[model samples]
Target: MKALRKIAAQAGVALEEVPEPSAPQGTDVIVEVEAAGICGSDLHVDDWTPGYEFMVPLLPLTLGHEFAGRIVAVGPDVEHVKVGDRVTVMPSAPCNACPACRAGDSEKCQNKQTLGLRRDGGFAPRVTARASGCLPLPDAVDYELAALTEPLGVGATAVRVGGVGQGDRVVVLGPGTIGQALAIFARLSGATDVAVVGFDDAPRLETCRALGFDQVYDLKEPGAMDRLKSDFGGCDVVFEATGKAVSITDGLALLRMEGVFVMAGIHEEDARFPATDFVRRRLQIRASHGARGPEWRRVLAAMAKEPEIFRKMITHRLPLDEAVRGFGLAHERGASKVMILPGQG
Candidate 1:
C-alpha cells in the first residue's frame, strides 16, 4: 500500500510503499482510506521548531485524522461495526474509562490518543483505528463530504458550547478552514445575524461572502471594531477562531451583556485580554474543543440534509501525492475545504 509518512528526524512527509495493517490485537479495525482531510492539526505535525508537539508519533508516521474509509477488517471484540461498512474516522481516540469519559466529556479524556497525532493515520491507502472512534457514514454521503464530518462536528460542538440561537447576533473571528466551518454550523444552529471578520482584506472575505454570512468584514481597516459594535448593540455571541491575541481581545469586546464567548482557536501562547470586560458584562466564557464520536454523527446527518449548500464549501481536492500543494492551499486564507483523495480519484 502507498502511504504518506513522515520519516524519523525530519519535518517533511513523503508518499512511499508500506505494508497493510491487520486488525489490532485489541478491539481495533483496519480501514482502507478513501479520502482524508488536511487540517490545522497537520500544520502542527510539520512544525519542527516547537517545544514538543505534545505527542509526536514514532517516526514514519502516516498523516490525517479527519477521514472516511471502508472497514476492510475488524477484530473479534469489535461489536458495533463490521467489514464493508463505511465510517468517518473520529480524530480523537479517547480512553473510555478515564475521568473525562466517565463524566460524559470524552473530548477531555485524560489518557486520550489521536489517530493522526501519535500513530498511523488515514493519509494512506489503508489505516487502522479503534473501532469505537469510528462514526458510521450514511450510504448517500460522498467520500469528499464524508471526510468533512469531523469538522462539521467541531461546528456543532461550538454552537452548543457558545449558546447561539434564533435571536443571537454572532460574530465569528477568523476566516480559516475551521472558522468557515464554524460559520456554516452557526447559521444552521439558528443564529440570525451571522458575521465573519477576517484579518486580511482578500480572498477569505470573498469566501465569507459566498458562504452567505449576514455580514463580512475585511478587518484590516481601522474602525472595524466600531462597525462590529454598530451591527448589534454589541454582538450576542462571539466564536473566536483566530489564534491571534488581538482577535481574541476583539472577540471579547464584541460580546453583548451576559452573552456567551466561545474560544475554538488553538493559540500557541497565552493571550492577554481584558479580564474586567467579562466581569463588567457578566459574560459566559466557554471553550469548545472539537466534538466526540457521536457528535460526528450529528454533523454527518446535518450534511446529509443540506448537501447543496454544504458540498459547495469544498473548494479544492487533490491527490495525496500533491500533499504539499494541498497543505499550502488549505493553510492560506484563499482556500476553503481541501481534501486528499488517497486512492483512485
Candidate 2:
C-alpha cells in the first residue's frame, strides 16, 4: 500500500510503501480508499502530539482522516454495510463501552482511536475500519463532498455548542471553509442576519448570498466593526474560526451584551484575551471540539440535500501525488476547500 506519512517535523509529507492491514476482527470492515481531505490540523502535525491516542502510532503516521471510500470487503460479522457499498468513514472509531460513548459524547471516549491521527489513516490504497466507522452515502452525494463531511461537522458542532437560534444575529469571523460552513449552519438555525466576516472571497460570498446570508462584511474594510454593530446590534453570538489571537479578541470586541463567543478554530497555542471584556460584559466564552459520529452524519445529510453549498465550498481538487501542492494552496488567498483524491481525480 502506498501511503503518505508525516515523516519529519515541519517538513513535507513523504510517500511510502506500507503493508496492507488485515480485516477487522469480529465486526469490522475494510474500505478501498477513494478521496481523502487534507485538514488544517493535519498541517499542524509537525508539532502536534496526539493526546488521546498518544500510545498509538505517531510520527510516520498515515496523514489523512477525512475520506469517503468503497467497501471493498467486510468481515463476516459485519451486517450494516456491504462490499462495494459507497460510504464515508466517520474518521472516528470510538470505544463504545467508554462512559463518554455511553453518554453520546463519543469524541470524549476514554479509549478513542481517531483515524488519521491515531491509526494508519486514509492516505493509502486501503484503510481497515470498524464497521461502525463507515457511514453509507446516498448516490446524490459525490466523493469530493463526502471527504468534506469532517470539516462541516466541526461547524455544526460549534453551532450546537453556541446555541445560536432563530431571530438571533450571528457573525462568523473568518471566510475559510470552516467559517463558511459555520455561516451555513447559522443560517439554518434561523439567524436573522448571519454576517460572514471577510472579503477575501468576493466570489464565495456571492455564492453564499445565493444560500441566504443577508449581511456580509469584510473585516479588512475600515470601521467594519461599527458597520456590523449598526446592522446586527453588535452580534448576539460571535464565532471565531480564524484561530488568530487577534481575531479572537476582535470577536470578543464585537459581542453584544450577554453575548456568547465560540472559538471554533484550532489555534496551536495559548492566546491572550481581554479579560476586561469578560469583567465588563460578563461575556460567555467557550471553544468547540470536533463533532462526533451523530454530528458528522448530520453534516453529510445536509450536504446531500444542498449541493449548492458544497459547490461553493470546494474550490480545488487534486490527486494524492499533488497533496503537498494542495496543502500549500489551502491557505492561499481566496481559497475555500481543497480536496485530494487518493488516485486520479
Candidate 3:
C-alpha cells in the first residue's frame, strides 16, 4: 500500500510504498481509509516544533489522525462494529487500567497512545485501530465529513468545558479548522453571539464569514477589539484557538468579568498571561485537549443535524500522493479543511 511516511525528523513527508495493515489480535480493526484531514498538529509535527520531541522517538511515523473509513476486517473480540461498517476512530486510545481512565476521565489517562502520531495512521490506504475506538457513522454523514469528527469533537469539548449555554456571547480567536468548528458548535450550544477573529488575508476567515458567523473580525483592522466590545458588550466565553502567545493575552482581555476562557489550541512554546487580571475578574481558565468522553457522540449528533454547514468547512481535497502539497496548503492557511483521499493515487 502507498502511505505518506515521515522518513526523517525534518519538515517534510514522503509518499512511499509500504505493507498494508491488518487486524492483529486483541480487538483491532483494519479500516480502508476513505478520507483523512491535514490538521494543525500535523503541521507542527512536520515542522518538528519545540516540545514535540516526543515524536522524535516515534520518527518515520505515518501522520494522520482525523480520518474516516470503512471496516474491512475485525479481530475476534471486536463486537461493537463489524466489517463493512463506516466509522471514524477516536485517535486517542486510553489505557483502561490507568487511574484517569478508571475515574472515567479517559482524556487525562496516564497512558494513551494516539494513532497517526504514536502509531501508523490513516495517511495510507489501510490502517489498523483498536475496535473500541471506532464510532459508527450515521447515514447522514459521509466519509469526507466523518473525517472531520475528530476536530469538531475538540470544538465541542471546548464549549462543554467553558460552560457555554443559551444566550451566552462567545469569541473564538483563530478561524482555522478547529476555530471554525468552535464557532459552529458554540452556536448550536445556544450561544447567540458567536464571533471569530483571524487575520484579514486568511482564506479560512472567508469561510467563517460565508458560514454566517455573527461577527468576523480581522485582528489587523483598526479598533477591531473596540468594535467587538461595542457590539457584544463582552464575551461570556472566549476560546483561544490560535495557539500563539499573543492570542492568549488578547483573548483574556476580551472576556467579561466571571467569564470562562477555554484554551483549545496546542502551543509548542511557553505562553504567559496576567495572573492579577485573572484574579481581579474572577475569570475561569480551562484547558481543552483532544476529544474524549461524551464529546464524540455530541459532535456526531450535531454534525448529523447540520451536515451541509459542517461540510462547507472542507475547502480542499487531494490524492494521497499529494500529501506534501496538502500539508503546505494547510500550513500556509490557504485551505480550511484539506482532505486526503488515501485510496486515490
Candidate 4:
C-alpha cells in the first residue's frame, strides 16, 4: 500500500510503497480510511516549519490527522467501538498514567502523542488509532462530512472560548476552514452578525460568502478595511484564526472596549502588539486549541443535524494516489477543504 509520509527533517512529503499495518494491538483499532482532509498543520509539516521540530525524531511518519473511516479490525480490549463502526478518530492520545488523565482531563495530558504528527496516521487506506479517540458517527453524517469534525471542533472551541452570545457582532480574522468554522459556530451561538476577513483570499473569502457570511472582505482591495470598519466596528467579539501576529492589531481595533479576542490559530512566530492601547481598553485575550471530548461530540452533533451546511467546506477531492496534489492545493490556498479519498482508486 502507498501512503503519504514526511520522510525527512525537511520540506515536502513523499508517497511510499509501505507494507500494510499489522493487526490492531491493545485498545487500538485498524480503520479503513474513507476520507482525510489536508489541513494547514499538514502543510506546516511538509514545509518543515519552525515550530514542528519536535517531530524531527518522528520523521517518516504518515501525515494525516483529520480523517473518518470504518473500523476493519479492533483490539481485544476495545469495547466502546467495534468493527464495522463508522467513526472519526481524534488524532491525540494521552498516557493514562499522567496526573491529568488520571483526573479525567486527558486534554492536559503531560505526555501526549498526536497520531498523525507523533505517530503514523490515516494518509493511507488503513491506519491504526486508539479506540478511545474514535467517536461513532450519526446515521445522517457520511464519511466526507464526518472527516470535518476535527477542524470544526477547533472552530467550536474558539467560539466557546470567545463567549459569543445572542445579538453579538463577531469578526473572524481568516477565511480558511477554521475561520469558516468559527463563523458558523458564532451564528449557531446566537450571534446576529458575523464578518469574515481575508488578505488576497478571493477563493476562501468566496467560500465564506457561500457559507452565508455576508460581510466578507479581501484586504487586498482598496478601501476594504475601511468598509469592514464601517460595517463591523466595535464588535462584541473577535477571533484571530489567521495565525498571523499582525491580525491581532487589526482585530483588536474593531473590538469594543473589554470585548473578547480569541486566538485560535497556531502561530509560527512571536506576535508583537500595542501594549498601551490594550491596557486602556481592558480587553481580554483567550487562546483556543484542540477541542475536548464533549466539544468533539457537540461538533459532530452539529454536523449531523445540518450535514449539508458543513459539507460546503469541502471544495476538492482526490484519490489516495493523487494525495500529494491535494497537499499542493491546500498550501496554495486554492481549495477550501480538500478531501483525500483513500478508497477511491
Model 4, C-alpha of 48: deviation from truth (Å) = 0.6
All candidates: CA RMSD (Å): 2.4, 3.0, 1.8, 1.2
lDDT of 3 by residue, 1-345 (tens): 788877787777888888877546779999999999998888888787776677777878888999999999999888899999999988888878889999998778877888988899999999999998999999999999999999999998888888899999999989998999899889888999898898664577889987778588887888987887777555799999988888888888888899888998888678898999989999888999888747888878877888898888999999998898898888777689999998777
Off by over 4 Å in 3: 96-106
TM-score of candidate 1 against the unseen true structure: 0.91
* Model 4 per-residue lDDT at 243: 90
Instruction: Provide the overall lDDT of each model, using Cα atoms, as 2-decimal numbers.
Output: 0.78, 0.79, 0.87, 0.93
User: What tens-digit string does per-residue lDDT give for candidate 2 at 1-345?
Assistant: 678787754446777888988866777788888888877776667334443235234666887888888998888899888999988888777778988999998668877777887778887878888887788897778888888888888899999889999898898987777887898888788887788877455765655565566578776678876887677666789998876778777788778888999998766567998898777998999889777878877888888788766766777888877777877787565556777778674
Best by TM-score: 4
Predicted model with the maximum lDDT: 4
Cα-lDDT of candidate 1: 0.78
> Candidate 1: how large is its RMSD?
2.4
Cα-lDDT of candidate 2: 0.79
Whichever of 2 and 4 has more lDDT, that candidate is: 4
Return the number of clashes found in candidate 4: 0
User: How far does residue 312 in candidate 4 sit from its true spot (Å)?
Assistant: 0.8
